[model samples]
Target: MLLQHAGIRPHPDYRRLMRALRLHAASPRGELAPEVYPADVANFFRRRRIPVAIVREGNTNALRKILAQVRRAPVMALVRGPEWGNEDHWIVLIGEERGMLVYLDPWYRPTQRYRRRMTNPVFALRWRGSAFSLSRGQAQSVRRA
Candidate 1:
């Protein structure tokens, strides 16, 4: 959805934000070049006058920080894995009230499908106090961008 908002099409081969960031292809200890990924994403949003903060860290702490930042402005997280061969990820937090949308890219097909398929499930308890939702159409819309 954030990509839809940004008017950027999702790449078919690299369907997830992290895959598109080229995070999976790096060596085990490889580090993402600071200027390339986050800077580019920041600039894209900046052109649209949307505030973007790219946080690079472990999931729990980084997510905490992102939630905090979302209180002040829209946030798009560009998360990298601690080591190479680990998948990187991106999650976009838009609007206040704790609503969010995540874009996860797994290196393997099973993991990818699992994350994408489990957006909302029956018998699953929905998260309360502001919900995070993903629209299936948004992924296709990203391709149209």
Candidate 2:
């Protein structure tokens, strides 16, 4: 993972982490965006012509609506890393199939610089119903070759 390779610790703040992830997405080559935040990600989606509907945080009613849309399409979760002090993390939740939570880990820019080459690739894993369970696994087998 770029995060791991970059040594950029995950932010504890879910909101901040999401923002960082969105910023990471702007650079396909793993460059960080000058300004990254939830709003940025939301705007990026909108500019790309992706439909976005903001829901109240932790709102069950809103969650249901979002989940319904996610089932029909891809849903990305901008969340905080377990160790992030207050920053949020960004994770894409494609769907629940075969008891797994498929997602993508976009590139991240860490404060520490490393000489090794790292490739940020999207993968899937079995959703264990917890943040920790969202492990990196092989890409969806269904993806085109």
The global C-alpha lDDT for each of the candidates, from Candidate 1 onward, is 0.39, 0.40
Given candidate 2, what's the lDDT at residue 57? 57
Query: Residue 143 deviation, candidate 1, in Å?
Result: 18
After the best TM-score superposition of candidate 1, give how far the Cα of residue 6 lies from its true spot, in angstroms.
Answer: 8.3
The clash numbers for all candidates, in the given order, read 2, 17
Best by TM-score: 2
Compared with the true structure, the alpha-carbon lDDT of candidate 2 equals 0.40
Each candidate: RMSD: 10.4, 14.3
TM-score of each: 0.33, 0.40
Encode model 2's per-residue lDDT on 48-103: one tens digit a residue.
33334554455565445545655554555554533333355555555555544444
Q: Write down the TM-score for model 1.
A: 0.33
**Candidate 1 residue-wise lDDT, 51-111, digit = tens:** 3345554445544554565454444444434321333444344544223343333333554
Query: Which candidate ranks first by lDDT, i.e. highest?
Result: 2
How many pairs of residues in model 1 come into backbone collision? Answer: 2
